[model samples]
Target: MEVEKARVLIVGAGGVGIMAAYALEVGGKAAVTLVMRSNYRRAQDAGISIDSVDHGKGIREWRPTEIRNTIPDVSQEGIPPFDFILVTTKNIPDVPPTVADLVAPAVSPGHTAIVLSQNGLNIERPLLARFPQNPILSSVSMISTTETSPAVVVHDFADAQKIGPFVPQPAAEAAARRYVAVYNGSGRLADVVYDADVPRARWHKLVYNASFNPVAAALRMDTARMRMSRHVVDDLVRPIMLEVVAAARAAGHVLPPDLPDALIRVDPVEAAFRPSMCQDADKGNLMEIETIVGEPLREGEARGVPMPTLRTVYGILKGLQLQTKVAKGLWEPAFDDDNPYR
Candidate 1:
């Protein structure tokens, strides 16, 4: 008897999505299908170019087990039910067609496992609310990879995936373990640990993400420049991170006292690194403000914690996002309150 491979559908073909697809395909235990939209033609015609530090160098034109321009509907011919649906897109909740809607067509109730490999805080709530029976694996990815261009990915720094179940039921735990096993089969990844407390892991990671990502975008600075700016790091970044720490603690996820310092002091190798939010801002795309900064702030405030610094940053990013949306014509500007146009 021959063993069957796990059929996996990756919904987003961004940097983290492509990286996940590559790792799964290279692992050889699963068949990975990547859904590409914008770069679909580029990926099909030229193939995805990988310049990865972990998976070795000079590997050009890499394709997954399968690539579809759109998410595969279960009714589609020759498309098998996917065991895992990985969503690696940015967690921008203000946008329409929520992530739940994007992956709902292919989701097999109580069977298809959902994995969120994106950024932000408290991101699992919407999915859990929509797909009540399915296993939700909330993952915090600690990798410095970027889609430099269409169909091109550059992974320079560490790559680690800390995932766990949202509810921690038997099915959820099993899904978490199986996903870890499949991902670990690659044997090249630095770390792919199954976290017992995924929410805590999320809060801990947010200490770095909620601080550096938006601040970097706001200042238009890379990791090196942010570090070089004594006032910026000391005054703005450090205080924001402390606020996150307080919020996490308020929410019952007690993080280490020195964790902020640990993340603030990045390795010299990752000096030129820019966060995803910064990249999004640079490309004139909508920044992920609400989920990354808003949700946690709300959670903290509800619990009587004051996040003054984080609140200020969130307000600034929200204003910037408003301007970006108006420029893109996704939103209309309302200047005068009494104007009919407003």
Candidate 2:
């Protein structure tokens, strides 16, 4: 008898999600299904095309074992439960249909592991609160892929990921190990690794996400343009990164003191790469300001650590979000007669 393959469902079909599905398919260890929201029609009709550096250039018109548009469709009666449900969507809790709601139906208590492959800090809180009995695997990815258009992906660089149990319970740890094995069984396309301390890993990634990501959006510049200016590095980027280190230390996740400098040294100085938030702002989409900046800032303040740089950037990004809302006609500005400026 043929052994049964592990079933996996990916919630977001962006560049990261597509690459993840590709990795799983290449391994042939599991049956992969992708939930495409924005490009469902295109993906269902034309399939996904990948221009990859790691998987080579011949991955045109690729589809996972299943293509789904909603979680409910996959959670229907008689279908086998997913062994893993990876949420690769951008972490914008401010938006409707919280990630908790989006992935709740497919969760199989004590069976399915919830994997988060997105950015930001404290992103697993809601999932933990909702599924106290299930395992929540937090991950930090180092892939460089982009969705230039609908159903099209450009995989330029590394496809690595480090995942760990969020709650660290026995069940959660086992889930993390299993996921690492499944993800890397096909020669480690995602280069999966297990991290015992995912929180510390989150803080390390935030040193860049909290600093360069927001700054890129606020300044309307890419990574190369921002790195071009010595003043920007010395004044804004370095300061914010240092503040993040301090904040992380205050939150009991002490990162390496040289982390900021090391990250700067390895940053692609010449690539005109746009971080996720920069791309969101350019498209007038909601950014993960609260999770990336607000949550850490609050964590610091609760511990009496001052984060003026983060606070200032948070305020600016909030204003930018408001601008986006107004442009989309989802929000209206109000004038108060008591205020002279109004």
How much lDDT does candidate 1 score?
0.86
Cα lDDT tens digits for candidate 2, 1-342? 766778999999999999999988887788898899889999999889998887888688899999988785445655778899998988888767899998888988768899999777788899999988789998899888988899899999878888999887889999899888888767846467999899888888999999988988898788777777877778788889988899889878978878888876666766787778999999888888989988888887788887888889899999998898789887789887787886
Q: Candidate 1 deviates by what RMSD? A: 2.2
lDDT of each: 0.86, 0.86
Inter-residue clash pairs, candidate 2:
none
Per-model TM-score, in order, reads 0.94, 0.93
Candidate 2 stretches greater than 4 Å from native? 73-77, 335-342
- Looking at model 2, residue 223 earns an lDDT score of 74
Backbone clash pairs for candidate 1 read: none
RMSD of each: 2.2, 2.3
Q: By summed lDDT, which 10 consecutive residues of candidate 2 come out lowest?
A: 70-79
